[model samples]
Target: MKKILVIEDEEFVRENILELLDSEGLEVFGAENGRIGVDLAQQQQPDLILCDVMMPELDGYGVLTTLRQDSILATIPFIFLTAKAAKVDFRQGMELGADDYLTKPFTRAELLGAIASRLKKQEAVQEHYNTEIQQAKDRLSYLAHHDSLTELPNRLSLQELFKQVQPQDDNYQEVLAVLFVGLDRFSKINDNLGSDFGDSLLKAVAIRLKACVDDQDIVARINADQFTVILAKRNHKKDAADVAQSILTSISKIFVVAAQEVFITASIGLAFYRRDSIELQQLLSYAKKAMLQAKQQGGNQYQFYTATFHIISVDYLNLETSLRHALEREELVVYYQPQVDLKTGKISGAEALLRWHHPQRGIIKPDKFIPIAEETGLIIPIGEWVLQAACKQTKIWQDAGFHCLRVAVNLSGRQFSQIDLSQKILQILRETGFHPQHIDLELTESMLVSNTEVAIRRLKTLKSLGMQIAVDDFGTGYSSLSYLQEFPFDILKIDRCFVRNITANPHNAAITEAIIQIAKTLELKLIAEGVETEAELNFVCRHNCDLMQGYLFSEPVPPQEFEKLLFSGKNLQFSPKQDHEAKVR
Candidate 1:
């Protein structure tokens, strides 16, 4: 029921107004003065307010002004009750934001008509605003769940759809398979034809993919040039494979885009459900790995996830378990690679790379185990150990008078996600007695893209604590020049891929040169990684690269061996032939 508040100094007039409103089916409330009326309006949230123009302590104009300042109360219909019918008085009340003015001795019709008109107008305005709000919300929801380029459901929508179709009971049975499809050499097409052409091609691909699927199945775009098909009610593995082959055939057909006949082939990876219970993300990963395997074999092919993949999955689990014990077993070690200043060929710093010495496996590279550690969330503790060990080593170097060299430690994405990451590093610094300036934290571009605002804030905190930040694997990820401008970074390490092929591939060389120019323009220290050859070293040096780290100097070694290099002094020069021979060995 609607509510109305009546405020008047005269007791008879206030009671009469309340009685009239009550008779009209409104829940009526009364206050003797403007202050009490404001309180009543707030508490009851009345649909309309009838107040006297003159009252003790506060007047009708004063009440109107005060209510206008409040967002909630400002919208309430207010009609002032005044003794004078003068034009000046009506003008004053309306100027104060009163909805309408009713003179004293006014008939009941005038009061009722004013209230009715104001309430109707308020209802219309509110309805319009609500409609606009809902439309905006719907648009946002659609954008969130769909790919903007192809107008296909995105990963988020895929997850939601999977949840909707997923069985409630654990023992429920259904034949379903997820097929991960990726266009081979799509980047080449994009690079050659341009992004607009690429977008059109992707849209065309989406339509073809959708056409290949049944009405009961779902097709979604998960990544750039990557799409996923959910084949529900497939009877067996063969059925899924047949669907995959059909999709491959459909996508491999020629398409005339922009008056050019473009022929493209796709790789398909199929992972079945009900055969093994798996989470949505894990299933997607399996399919993606299978797709990559298919691509490796050659495009226009399909590969079903096999036992070999399952063995790798089991191996990952075992590795995670082994890593948890690695720190306790003293199997985890920090290996240091010296960073040489290209200008002076002097040791300026070193990066602390993590390694694991398995009892049976002998030695395991980080690439094989780091992803497992990250997936299992073991990187948090493992990262802490790395930070502590690296800091202690830096302190040891400082105590031995190697004060000019800093140590860089790579921080995993999980570690950076910690809310207290800065505080934890500070605690480590205090415990190890290492100067904050002597340590640098290396992060990849992927880490910065997920929660950029939070990453920036956390990085700024670390910077304030005197810790250096470096963007590792610089050109390999989705990092843009804007990232460099917005993020607080002290160094950019050119990824090994570019440096390794720089001499043979002009494109790689051009990218390396562009990175060098960017680093120079930003005044950030540039370090070229994987510099294995004398020619690569000379190329970087000629470009005025700030620092260099690769086998050309020394492979990452244990702390004791690195200490020997430190003792040999900062300018531990070696001939190009000698460095190349060492790299070969």
Candidate 2:
């Protein structure tokens, strides 16, 4: 039952209010003075507090302030009942956090209505606080057992749950199934949205995922944008696959938040657990490796751990070990892909792409080891290196007579969240002696969507440095077109998928045209990526595309080769082979 505490020194008025509330189906607790009222409040933690501001022993302000100091009672709504009618008195009561103020000789209806409003407000406030507290607790609990971002069971949670399903000493036959789910564009979300909003979207995704699973199954957020599910001991691979599909389906559904709808997808990696020799971390590693393989094959899919995949994983582990050394050894090279002015066919700028020159592996692709770096937080250092390296190269290019050419470096959304990224970039540019206008930072759509405010602020700061900002993979994102104007971007790189079919597919052509038109309207440069054919090039050029980059112009070539191409002046070497070959670049 709802309870109300009434504190008034006047016997007649205090009793009258108590009787009125009592008759109105509420439990009324009366106190003769403010001191006793505060004591009763701490003890009862009543639904509401009604106190006369001018009471003896302790004034209403004193009682309210005292209770407000205690976190437990701070939120309990307080109403002031006083004979003082001056605006100053009312102002004082409000400043004390009084929910409402009732002057002396108030009507029963007016008093009752004020009391009712305070009670309702209190109820609403409590509900909101409870939800926030519960969310915080859940977040902490999730962090304890799972990856805070992915809402996947953490290493600890996995170990605890894995042990529960481990076959006993007597039974070697029992097997436990585990599936690791990874999002293809989860980092994109973080890269586009600031980390907080990225975390919010992830938490929301986690809730959806949890709702899709069975009560008996153990699912936890394990790693960044990775979910680990411990299926029942006897659950079949097909069953796990079905659940994974359900998870993908659920997350794929448009999530309408803050008046906008967003969509996301995940890739699953599955492995069975054996108590004989396999450890928790080993199983998890295997699962994640398999998931990476699945993502490599193309996301929105699943892969089961197999001996063949393990062989690849072993190689990848070796690569990861070598990657750290490669950074220290300065074996990581930056390749530049030229962006050409579509109308004049002039070399406008270049995107600085990273390549690992592994001593044993020859050349390593970004897709092969980038995820590992991101997962292990090596991306922070690698990204810093990329930024500084790109700036250094831009300075070198300027010294070598390419002064006007801009060098665009991709910034991982994670790098932007470091609180000083803008400053860091500016410092790098200053230290490297690169002209700020000759550098561009390519951020993905996900970074802008995840945290609009932070991303905007960071980008704005970067823009203030006179560096251009471009949104990479523009078409394939969750950001709304309405927010397009708010972000500090100078260019939009149309995703290759959209550009790939534009030549042959009318629908794709229309979408690409619309994108170009939007860019034109915004007075932003439009770069059509992944163009593989003359027909595609012609289509883009016909639309007056500002820039174009793909194999058609040049695959991301080494700096030496790129420089040679510049010296040799081979402007356009693109020759469309066949209509059938007109696929993804």
Name the top lDDT candidate.
1
As for candidate 1, its clashing pairs are none
Candidate 1 structure quality by residue, lDDT tens digits, 524-578: 9888899888778877776777788888778999999988877876452435753
Judging by TM-score against the true structure, name the best candidate.
1
Candidate 1's C-alpha runs over 4 A off are 163-174, 310-585
User: Judged by lDDT against the true structure, how good is candidate 2?
Assistant: 0.77
TM-score of each: 0.56, 0.49
Tens-place lDDT per residue, model 2, 249-355, is: 88888877656666777788878766312676777778888788889888888888876764355676887788777788988898988888654466778889999
Model 1 lDDT, residue 126, Cα: 85
- Report lDDT per candidate: 0.83, 0.77
Count of steric clashes across candidates, in order: 0, 21
Worst 10 residues of 1 by lDDT: 576-585
For model 2, the run of ten residues with the poorest summed lDDT: 576-585
